[model samples]
Target: MVLADLGRKLTTALRSLGNSPVINEDVLKKCLMDVQRALLEADVNIKLVKQLTDGVKKQIDLDNIGTGLNKRRVIQTAVYKELCRICDPGVKPWKPTKGRSSVIMFVGLQGSGKTTSCIKLAYHYQKKGWKTAVVCADTFRAGAYDQVKQNCTKARIPFYGSLTEPDPAAIAYDGVEIFKKEKFDIIIVDTSGRHKQEDSLFEEMLQVNNAVEPDNIIFVMDASIGQACESQAKAFKDQVDVGSVIITKLDSHAKGGGALSAIAATQSPIVFIGTGEHIDELEPFETTKFIRKLLNMGDIEGLIDKVNQLKLEDNEDLKKNLQKGRFTLRDMYEQFQNILKMGPFNQIMGMIPGFNDFMNKGHEQESTKRLRKLMCIMDSMSEEELDSPEGHKLFKNNDDGSRRLRRVARGSGSSPKEVFELIDQYQKFAQMVKKMGGMGLFKNGDLSKNMNMQQMNQINGHMAKMMDPRVLQQMGGMDGLKKMMQQFNQSDGSGRPGRGGMGGLGALGGLNFK
Candidate 1:
């Protein structure tokens, strides 16, 4: 799970301890210890975790009744604030000059995912209605031109690069001129990733910076490098006015705790996070929401925003159907499609306060498969059979339920047991919705409140079984799953990874599961 997500779960568990007229010192201490343990287990820096815990404790101890804020709330808020401060380095937003194209230069060490990031950024701006072009200045790499060109082609963005041109600075200058002539709104220059000791390569980067005169210079760092990421960031900052930092490979990093700390030490605001290696695997760094999630607090604002973006209101018919506890197969199919738009199942689960921890336990893939199987079974039902309760009754009574089940099983290429399982699961879900007062419960936050420890544990256990790599292979393997995740991550200009179709399953074998 993401650090922010882990924090959210920890905070929620702490809040579960009732608020009182007076702060319970023992309970507070226990809560803090729990928080500390959770962070440590997530590979957060020990020192940093202590600093955070201590800060919260100090705030709690100094609390006054007159402030109107409960001691627990105060402590929770303080911890949230501190985490945000550390995660975000206070870097100014990239503001492009009006009526003029802005130039962005990408820099990083070798294998830090610089080239891919450049293309992704261009794609992001292009989606924002900007005419974007890419400049391949990394003549050092033999196939750099082809790589950038291919990415540009995939994104349908323009590219300017010449294999014959040996001078990096001259290429950048020409690229910029060509972009100007082409009337592109943004020009992104991709430079070769060079080490600090490579004086000649560094000099070339500086020359390109001067020649291109980019409005924004972003240093891409690998989060997997841990503490060393600090020095690399600092070295780059010293050379160029490093406007922001993009830490990549976060999805695979065990010690991602250093990610925030490194940005904190460098005094660079984290503008983006690269969660995976795909072109779209980036997310905007939201300080408040991230910190809140890390502390196990619900990001209500983020949730609201997502709801609005998805135009949930437009689906009034579906909402009404759900409110009546009359979920049909068609409704279920639409819900699956909507969830797909929201990104990966793991990511969506992370947005929930307590579920984030369960997700970090590495059970997301399993849960996703179950949901997909359920969706497929629903897909096999006819429109009339789905819409009418009587139709379902007849279908189930005639021993036709068996025949229909077999048909669904065959249609979905799944077992009849799987089809039966989906029907049973949806029946339970429908019952829960009815008990909770239907879809209104979601808006009123009643759904979250009703989610008890037992239910959460059950969900986690099921998720664990579903996400097992072996189970995924039975479905289609890592290549298929990774592509799905990439699509989920890259849904918006936020740069989350895209589900790159079904070809990414092979890469899963190399994943360090632990």
Candidate 2:
């Protein structure tokens, strides 16, 4: 079973239990059986599956349960924890320290996304203010150097590779020395991806590992390989000190169960998982959060981290406008830019509870394209038009409303109708902000602080009316909607208070850009 399918099966089983009028031992047994089947089908090692199920069963002693307790919730929590246990090897992966050079060597079978993972990790640290660099020591493969060079150049990260060098160990040695001399914080050495039959290549991997003397050895596993991931991870672990794992192609893999097996095989925790082919698609792995997302429970902390990464405090001008309940065209455009920065729309939505189903319905691409078009329309606007507090009304004051709309359409390379639609969306957004201001939600810098439960409920209800019917339905109606908003208000990006700003609202609420 694919991860999505597994989640659905488990969720269905649990939901059925929730719907049952009388909770009995049979219901719990049936739920566990379904979970066990799902995990086994997902390619999780049978032993681990049994252990996880057994753990859940032991935790839920129906006879000892209090009448006040929700039996269904208790069982669900046990299953969640047990699932997390199977994924977590209980070993911490090596982490690079800032202001210090930490060499990380990559090793894996061919086509495991080793090369891409290296660039992604380097870029990940680079975004966090680390001076990162990549060293391509995969001389065994043709075009490996070219691939690294091209990707590194595009990412603007310094890289070292030699097409002429036949010795990968020498290349690794030189690259590490150069980066160390440059005082780079994170030095990643990408080695040749070797197969079990390729003994020479495995020897070369060891040589490069010795040459770089890496602080961490990352074993890249292909999630699509099913049980093969365990053998491959064990092979690499035998050859080198595999300190961490990076599972690639997780976004599309039907057999990501192999990923769980690989963890148990190597006894090393996964550091990240490659969700997509894009360079920025690698996500840091946390067992609990990963299991939560797998079960469609959402990853709220991950969502907050992404929002915090935007550093919205720098946008004082936009903050002031939002607080005053005034949203200009430029504000909307800037929010779009932030959305793009926050990574893929699907990835962001996956962090929200109940969005998995919406994403599965395949609206990610449609929403993304719509957002870009809205940005382009705004991009065509003049400074006066974008900054005007009159928003959509600013166009009406023109000598001819159609003339200004036509000009914007021509500039944006879109139809006048599309431009008009953009303005209409902008009006809806401005109205929401104005309504929020009227309710005193935006009176304080932190919107989370001012709103009581009643006010929050009112705002959620209002936002629900503006939301697409399909999305609202997937969110489990108003309660799901309120939970999503409370998630945003409970913490800013850092899990601290004062998230009542435009960052939280625009990220989820204002995104109702039809």
Candidate 3:
């Protein structure tokens, strides 16, 4: 089962407790049973699953229950805590020092995505202003050097690898030396993973480890290889001092549970997780956020981080226009561009609370295509039409807006109705922004920090009118929007990650919702 499915099952189990008015032993017992069943189906190691359930039960002391204690809340928290313990090794991950060269070596069995992860890490660091380089020392596997070289080249990361190098350790040593001379802050070495855990492979890995003396040794495991991950992780940890773990192909992998099992076996923290083949798909493993997203609670923190990384200058321009209450079709189009940069829509929706279950297969792709079509429609407009709040004005002032709409539709290879729809969408967004601008939300630069509940409710009421009737209803209407805002406020007020002064998003700085 996927982690999202496991989360849903566990959440259903927990909700059963809430449904029970009497917090009796039977309810708790059934809940634990459901949790155990879900974990087992996920391919979690049975022993670890038992240990987690046992821990949760031990945390609950019904006989010693105190006043004002909510038994349901206690049990839920205990279950969440136990699941985290199962995945967490409780060891500190190695941190690269600023201004000092740090070498990270990747090791794993063949086909474990070791080389791809090396490039991902290098690219990740490079984006953060670190001078990063990659070294390919996988002499055992033919084309290993070629793969690493090509991936690094695509990312523009400096790389060093010798095709004629017979000894991978020698190549690793030389690569490190070259990068250090170049003052690269982060150097990643990708070693051979072609052989099984035999004497020669282990010997070579050990030799390379000794040669580079890397700051961290990351053990990459294919998450689809269930149960075997534990032994593989143990074998690597026993020989080469594996410091951290990175599980790849977690999505669509029934063995994600087994990947968790490896963490306990190696006692190494998972520093990152590879979700997809894209270089940007490597996600930093945060325990709370992982558990939260697993349970479909949404990773608002991650969503905010993604937006912050965009640094969208066009978004900043939209923000300025919004503050002046001069939002236009041009500004709406910029917002669409920013959304595209944030990655797939459902991926974004998955990070929002209460939206996971609503997303359907092909829905994101369809939405993306529609967005492109809208952009194409905008491209066909004149500069005055593009900047005007009412794009229909261009046609309405002369003939029917239909004439201009038809011309745009033909140019953009769409129907007049579709062109009109884009204009309608722009109008709704502009109206909402104008309303927000009048509320003085951005005047103090706090973005409605001073607004009371009544004001928020009034604003949402109007915005809700501009939304699709079905979507507005699916979001629990105005009350649901208010509850969502309350969740944000509570989390931010408590200084949660990506919360506090950041507000709804600096990226959403002058957006109507902000």
Best by TM-score: 2
lDDT of 1 by residue, 1-514 (tens): 5654455546655665665445677777777787777666655567778888877766666435456656666766766676666676566768665578889999999989889888888876775678888999999988899999888898898999998989999999999998988777889999989987788888889999999899889888876666667667777777888887777777666566656656755676777777655565566667876665565443434433343345544566665654464555565556565555555544555554444555653566765565576677777777776676333353466577888888878988999887776665445444544443433433321123334445534433433333545545532454444433333223332444322111111112111121
Worst-scoring 10-residue span by lDDT in model 2 = 441-450
Give the C-alpha lDDT of model 1.
Answer: 0.64
**Per-residue lDDT of model 3, residues 294-380, tens digit only:** 776776666766665665433566557657766777766766677777765655656666555554336556666777878898888
Candidate ordering by TM-score (highest first):
2, 3, 1
State which candidate, 1 or 2, has the greater TM-score.
2
Off by over 4 Å in 3: 194-196, 312-316, 344-347, 395-400, 444-446, 466-475, 489-514
| lDDT of every model, 2 decimals | 0.64, 0.83, 0.76
Candidate 1 error regions (>4 Å):
4-76, 97-99, 126-130, 314-327, 378-391, 425-514
**Could you give the candidate ranking by lDDT, starting with the highest?**
2, 3, 1
Candidate 2 lDDT, 285-381, residue by residue in tens: 8888788888889877788778778887678787688678888888888888888889887788888887776785258778888889888888888
User: Candidate 3's C-alpha lDDT?
Assistant: 0.76
